[model samples]
Target: MTTITRRTVEYPADGLTMVGHLALPSGHDRRPAVLLGPEGTGISDLQRRRADALAELGYVAFAFDIHGGRWFSDPEEMLARCLPLLADPDRLREIGTAARDVVLAEDRTDPERIAAIGYGTGGAVALELGRAGVPLQAIGTINGLITGRPGEAAHIRCPVWAGVGSEDPIQPAAQRDAFAAEMQGAGVDWRLTIYGGAGHAFHHPLDELPDQVLLPGVGYHEKHAARAWRDVLGLLGECLPSSN
Candidate 1:
């Protein structure tokens, strides 16, 4: 097993002191970096574990925060903070860019090689970064199929891959269609995978978060979660292969 080192990083974004988790691989040489965005509820240990897993795979991984250092156990509170933020693309871009900068500042990160992968509202932030013309090697979103402003997606410079549950009410079929149309109209390289019978946030294991509210259409499927991780790995490998 590769030796992985982890630490907590503090930075500012949108008037909040954002706390992020950074994971470094075994070596000192610069490697491809991934800016990971957490779900709408906020940064959790789950996101940190994902970053560590990426480090074990030889990538400099930074799991960035969306809700400072807070985690919302109430659905209404989470929505109160995220709903407005989600409607504003510029704000999302600002948050995502802050996280990206954190990854870039790391000594082990390759300045020219980076990707953005996010979940839920965080996924939307990743897409916003792409639309803002940030040079990301790849963009991957899980359960965040959001459509951007008119003609903005044309600025995206790399392939985008999204995973969602087929029965996700939060990201229904119509929203998915609109997202697809935007990508297609912009001539951007994009792909979508709908996990059959799954629901929103299918990639997240709620069992690990016993206090979390069980929102409608939000459940976890172990099989699909594993598959989604594999698909994301494929996207990263295809777009930004990290050197061992």
Candidate 2:
């Protein structure tokens, strides 16, 4: 196993100091990198572990923070902040760009090889990065924002992979259809995977079971989460091959 170094990374976003975590693999090789986005609750231990896992896979991974340096355990508090942020495109752009710049400036990141994979609000940020015309190798989101802004999705120039639960209350059938239609019209190479019987934020298994039930239509399915991770890794392999 390669030694992975997890470090603290703080940057400015949302009028606050956002603290992210960077995981670098042991070696001098400038590997491909991934900008990981956390769920609305903010950067928790689960996200840090995710960055560590990505580093173990030999990719320079940085888990971006959502709500500054603080994490909200209360669902209402989280929603109060996340719901509003999700509605604003400019705010998402500012947050996503800060994290992208942080990873791009890292010594171990291959400038030409970068991808963004996020969950919920983080995933929307990833999509925003692509919509903002940033040339990303790939974009993967698990239960993230599926809808695109008017005439903005045309700027996305890379492949996008979005996974959602069929029973996800937040992402209804209408929204899914609209997102796919727009991506198709824009000619973006995008694929949407609907996991049967799953709900929102299904990729996170490390979260407590009690809290999972608290969030309506948000549950953890080990099988689906594993499958989603595999899909995300496959997308990265297809777009940003580690050999390159």
Q: Provide the overall lDDT of each model, using Cα atoms, as 2-decimal numbers.
A: 0.94, 0.87
Model 1: per-residue lDDT, tens digit, 153-201?
9999999999999999999999999999999999999999999999998
- Worst lDDT 10-window in candidate 2: 205-214
Candidate 1 shows a clash count of 0
lDDT per residue as tens, model 2, 120-225: 8899999999999988999998888557688899999899999899999988788789888988898999999999989987877644534432578878888998
User: For each candidate, how many residue pairs have backbone atoms clashing (under 3 Å)?
Assistant: 0, 0
Q: What's the lDDT for candidate 2?
A: 0.87
In model 2, how large is the Cα lDDT of residue 50?
A: 81
Which pairs clash inside model 1? Answer: none
lDDT of 1 at 146: 91
- Deviation from native of the Cα of residue 196 in model 2, angstroms: 0.6
Error of 2 at 121 (Å): 0.4
- Candidate 1 residues lying further than 4 Å off, grouped into runs, are none
Clash pairs detected, candidate 2 = none
